[model samples]
Target: MTVEVFALGGYGEAGGRNMTAVRVDEEIVIFDCGMSLDKILIFEKDFQKATTRELRKVNAIPDDSPLKPHRSKVVAAVLSHGHLDHIGAASKILFRYQCNIFGTDFTVELVKSDLKGEERYRSETEDIKISMYAVEPGDEVQISSKLRLEFIPISHSIPGTVLPVLHTPYGAIVYACDFKFDDHQLLGYKPDYKRLKELGKEGVLLLIPESLRVKEEMKTPSEAVAREMVKDTLQFAEEESEGIIVTTFSSHIERIQTIADTAERLGRNVMLVGRSMGKYARIAEELGLLNLPPGSRVYDKPETVARGLHRANKEKEDWLLIVTGHQGEPGAVLPRIADDELPYKLTENDSIVFSSSTIPSPLNKAQMYSLDTKLRMKGVKMFKDVHVSGHAGREDHRLLLRMLQPEYILPAHGDADMLSAYAEFASQEGYEINKDVFVTFEGTKVTIPL
Candidate 1:
């Protein structure tokens, strides 16, 4: 038995789309279908007008041209998590192959919401259809007589992230994308290392791990550290400032949970004011994962936000306001408030804690600085980078390699430079490049040799 591996997308950049495929003889499974936000921004206003081929040309979506030849042979499309860069392109692209979609509960809802937003796109593809299946951490998906899939729960910024493992007659293929090994994760269960080692003992033929932060020298901090950071900042602002406004990833329910618990302890009311926060909050609530205190307010609509802020302003109430726009997106809630479009007013000594990191692009940096200027002009106090990354750093990557002990190594979700660092690390661990360690990019395909 043999398996062919394809680096469909997410090869040469950061904050880009991540898609991978593994084919065992006649059956195939695609790992993820994310889109490049930078590429998509050029055609953002009229996404429906942009053809799939056009998106591919700009590298907005995965270069799925490689899979077109075996389109009908696709057995399933699986997403590792609900992050936009992991599941963004699935609703638009996977349906073209008429395959079943698999994800965790939150991720399934994310795909459904994406599809619902693309009504015109779905309408045009009248003959194409897809089904979404919700699979838990330990659930196994049987693709064909020769292939089986298992989702192993892993900790990330989001609540329902998983590491996918494919079991085939040839061997087990592990897709460890966008994860941090947090034994004390605040959101979900710890990394299933026992199960991972068990599968390793059964012989993992090919291991494709995300190398986004492999250059960092140590193991990544636990999510609990971020929670403490948030708590400390909120406590400080409660005593030292007039009001507190914080921003973080909307999908970070664990952070949100920490914020809510800490705000309650500090005797401040919690108000969530962002469309994305509302969407993810509702998704987590439905899955019984959100544990917000009763009476915590969520304002999704612009009018509702303005009204709530107006009331807070009128009462001179000191509340903890959680918002989106950590990257300073143009139309996000934080920018609107900074522009005075919202009813909220910034005043002296009011703290703004940034619990997120910028993607380090010129465009993102420019926007963030613009927002910073606006807030500073109003005398708003600022706190930044009070966060921990969700990717495996160099030490964690080394440990994972030791635990899995696969025959070959393939690094995904990073550019050539990052992959080069990872390749060197693999060599130090005794795997020779091009023979046991494969460093590939988008559109490159490899046939696994044992």
Candidate 2:
């Protein structure tokens, strides 16, 4: 038996570009189909000049033939989680291959929301049928004669991120992407330590782990810290202020839930704005993962939200406005409001809270500084960094390494420097440079023969 792995997208860097395939005998199993942040910012620069078709080509599969050859033999597209960096390309690639998609319940809902608009676009162009298999953590799905997949729940900012354990003929390969070890998780149950130790005892042959936070020395903080920050900022605001705006990542369902809870405590009528925010919230609530208060509203239409904010500003003392553009993305609702593009205006004591850290990208930094200047000019009270990362840090990575004890370690989902740091850590644990530890880039394939 022989198993071959290919990094179709996310290898050297992070964001929109991520595609990985494992070929075992005649069957092909895909891990993720997503785009990179690099690709999105490039396309955004010349929005009017570039079409979706063109952007798709820039991030297309390296060679369509390898995927097409065994397209019929493809058993499943197993998603590690619901993050766009992991599942965003489903709308573009689902039509190309005929396979069942397996993911956690919340991950499936999040994917459905992402593809909703794309489905309409595809329907206008061609006939497509996308079926989603929603499985919970610990549920096992046999894809082919030699492949068994299971989802092991992990603590992340999102509700249903999983560490995929693929039981192949040669050995089990665990794909650990985009996860953190939060012993003090605020919303859901804690990480399944017993299951993880059980898998560790079973003996993993290959461990593909995320290296996004490997450079950081400390373990990522828990979601509870973010809740405290939110509480402090909200309490600091004027007692009679009407507008209280908070912005964060749209996929952060836990943070959104916490925000909603805080709003209820503060006697505020919660309002969720932004296209993606409303879509994800509704899906999360439908799955019974999120429960909004009786009268909370979610609005996607900008004009309607503007009018509602105007009315709420006049009468309500506690009106929570949850929005997008936490990184100051141009034209996002928060930036638009800061620029006075919205009908409502920020008063002296109105609060604007950023429940997120500025991603370290240059473009994000510049846009955030520009937005801060604008909001400052309007005398808006801005609170920042009321958030914690969802990625495991250096100490978390060390713990995972000690638990798994895989034969081979491959650092993934990070740039060369970050991956290199991870590789160095493995060396300290006595892993050989090339024989036991492998660092690769996109288009590179690693093979194990049996």
Tell me, by TM-score, which candidate is best. 1
Instruction: For candidate 2, write residues 1-450 as lDDT tens digits.
Output: 667777666777754366678877777788877656545654644422343466566663223345665688778888888777787767667656778898888878777766666554444655567778998788998887789998887888888888888888767888888788987776544778888788788888888888888889998988888778778777776474657899998888888888888888888878888777887888888888888886788877766778766666675575788998888887678888888777667887788888998877677889889999999998877778888898899888888888888888877888777778889988988898788788888777887544
Q: What is each predicted model's overall lDDT from 0 to 1?
A: 0.85, 0.78
Could you give the C-alpha RMSD of every candidate to the true structure, in order shown? 1.9, 2.6
lDDT of 1 by residue, 409-446 (tens): 89998878888888999999999999989898888999
The local lDDT score (0 to 100) that residue 32 gets in candidate 1 is 93
Q: Lowest summed-lDDT stretch of 10 residues in model 2?
A: 43-52
Clash totals in order: 0, 10
Backbone clashes counted, model 2: 10
lDDT score, candidate 2, position 165: 84
